[model samples]
Target: MIYTVTLNPSIDYVVYPDEPIQLGQLNRISKHHKYPGGKGINVSRILSELAIESTALGFVGGFTGDFLKQQLQDRAVSTAFVEVEEDTRINVKIKGESETEINGAGPHITPEKQAELVSKFRQLKQGDIVVLAGSKPSGLPGDFYQQLIRLITEKGASFIIDTTGDELMQSLEHQPFLIKPNRDELEELYETVIDSKEAVVQYGRDLLNKGARHVIVSMGKDGAMLFTHEGIYHGSAKPGRLVNSVGAGDSMVAGFTGTFEQTKDIKEAFRYSLACGSATAFSEDLAVKEDIEKVLQTITIKQWEE
Candidate 1:
C-alpha cells in the first residue's frame, strides 16, 4: 500500500481579482478556490486522478482540519490523519497583477502529538511505500523525518522525501528511496548556480552518491531528468499556456510514485512525472486523468547520453 505523510497540511485559498488590487481596500474576485493544501495531500489527490489508491496520514485539527479531511474524502482519497489540538492553517493567494501570498502557521505539534504520529508510523510494514513531504510544524524535532526514515527502513518499507535544504540532506544518510528536488532546490543544496545540463546531471549524481537511490530533478518548461543506478533518462514537458503552478511539483511526485508502483518501469515513471506536472501547470487546478493523458501524448522520454 502507498501512504503519504503531511506534517503540516493547509487549506489553500486562491483568489483571482476582476481588476487590479487597491491598497488596503476590498478587492472583488472574478473567481476563487479552496483546496486541501500540503505536499503529501496534493500527491495523494493527483494519485487518485491516476486511479491509484493511497492513504493520507498526517496531523490535522480544528475546523480547517475538518474541512481538509472532507475535501480529500470528496476526492476519494483515503485518509488517517492524527488529530491535533491546534487549528490547521489557511494560506491565501491573491492572483492579480502578480501573485501575492499570506500563509498562516499551523498548530504547534507538541512532543506528545509528535509521538502520536510516530505511533501511527509503526503500522507500516514491508513493501509499503510511504511519502514524507512538506515542512515540519513548530516544536517538532529537526530530525523528525530522519528518524522516520530509519524506522521505515528497518521495517523494509521504502520512503521518498519531497523536501529541500537540511531536512532533505539530514535524511540522505538513511538512504531514502527517492528525492524530488527542483533545479532551484538543487542549486540551494549544493550552494552554487547550476548553469547547464551537464551541471544538472552531475549534481544529481552527487546526491546519488550521498544516499538517494534515485534523484529526479524537475526543470519546469525545460522538462525533468531522472538519475537512477542504471542510467540517466530525460522527459520533456508538454507545451501549454500556464494557468496555475501550485500543484505541479506534487503532481510530479504522485505521477512518478503511482506509475512506478504499478509497472516498476523507471522510464515510464519519468514520462508520467513530466506529463502530470505539465497537466497541472496548464490547468487552474490540479489536473485530472484526462488532462494528464493529453499531456502524455506530447511527452517523449529518452535516455540521457553523455
Candidate 2:
C-alpha cells in the first residue's frame, strides 16, 4: 500500500478577481473555488486519477479540517488524518494579472498528537511506499520527519520526500526511493546556478551520489530529466497554456512513483510523470484520467545524452 503524509493541510481558496487586485482596497472576485490543499494530498489525488489507491495520512482539525476531509472523500481518496485542536488553515490564492498567495501557518501539533500519528506507521510493512510531502506545522520537533523516516525504514517500507532545504538534504542520507526537486531548488541545494544541461546533470548525479535511489530534476517548460543508476532519460509534453501550477510537481511525483511501483519501468514512469504534470499545468485543478490520457499521447521519452 502507498501512504502520503501531509503534516500541514489546508483549504486552498482560489479567488479570481473581476479586475486586477488593488492594495488596501475593497476588492471583489468574480468566482472562487476551494479544494483540499497540501503537497501530499495533491499526490494522493493525482494517484487516484491513475486508478492507484493510496491512503493519505496527516494532521487535520476543526471545521476546516472536516471540509478538507470531505473533499478528499468525495474524490474517492482514503485518508487517515490525526485530529488536532486548532482549525486547519485556509490558504488564499488570488488569481489576477498574476497569482498571489497568502498561506496560513497551520495548527500547532502537540507531542501526544504527534505520537499518535507516528504510531500509525507501525502498521506499514515491506513493499509499502510512504510519500512525505509539504512543510511541518509549528511546535513539532525539527526532527519530526527524520523520526518518521526512521520508523518507516525500520519497518522495511520505502519513502519519498518532497521538500526543500535542510529537511530535504537530511532525508538524502536515508536513501529515499525517489526525490523530485525543481531546477531552482536544485540550485539552492548546491548553492550554484545551473546555466546548462551539463550543470543540471552534474547536480542531479551529485544527488544520486549523496544517496537518492532515483532523482528527477524538473525544469518546468524546458522538460524534466530522470537520473538512475542504469542511465539518464529525458521527456516533455507538447507546449500548452498554463492554467495552474499549484499541484504540477506533486502530480509528477505521484505519476512516477505510482507507475514505477506497479510496472517497475523507469521510462514509462518518466513518460507518465511528464504527462501528468503537463495535464495539471493546463487545467484549473489536478488533471483527471481523461486529461492525463490526452497529454500522454503527446509525450515522448529518449535517452538523455550530452
- How many pairs collide in each candidate, listed in order? 0, 0
Q: List model 2 lDDT by residue over 118-161, tens digit each.
A: 99999999999999998999898999999999999999999999
Worst lDDT run of 10 residues, candidate 2, spans 297-306
List model 1 lDDT by residue over 208-256, tens digit each.
Answer: 9999998999888888999999999888865789888888999998999
* Superposition error at 131 for model 1 (Å): 0.9
Q: Rate the local accuracy (lDDT) of all candidates.
A: 0.91, 0.94
Cα RMSD (angstroms) for every candidate in the order listed: 1.2, 1.1
What's the true lDDT of residue 302 in model 1?
86
Q: In model 1, how large is the Cα lDDT of residue 283?
A: 93
Model 1 CA lDDT for position 247: 82
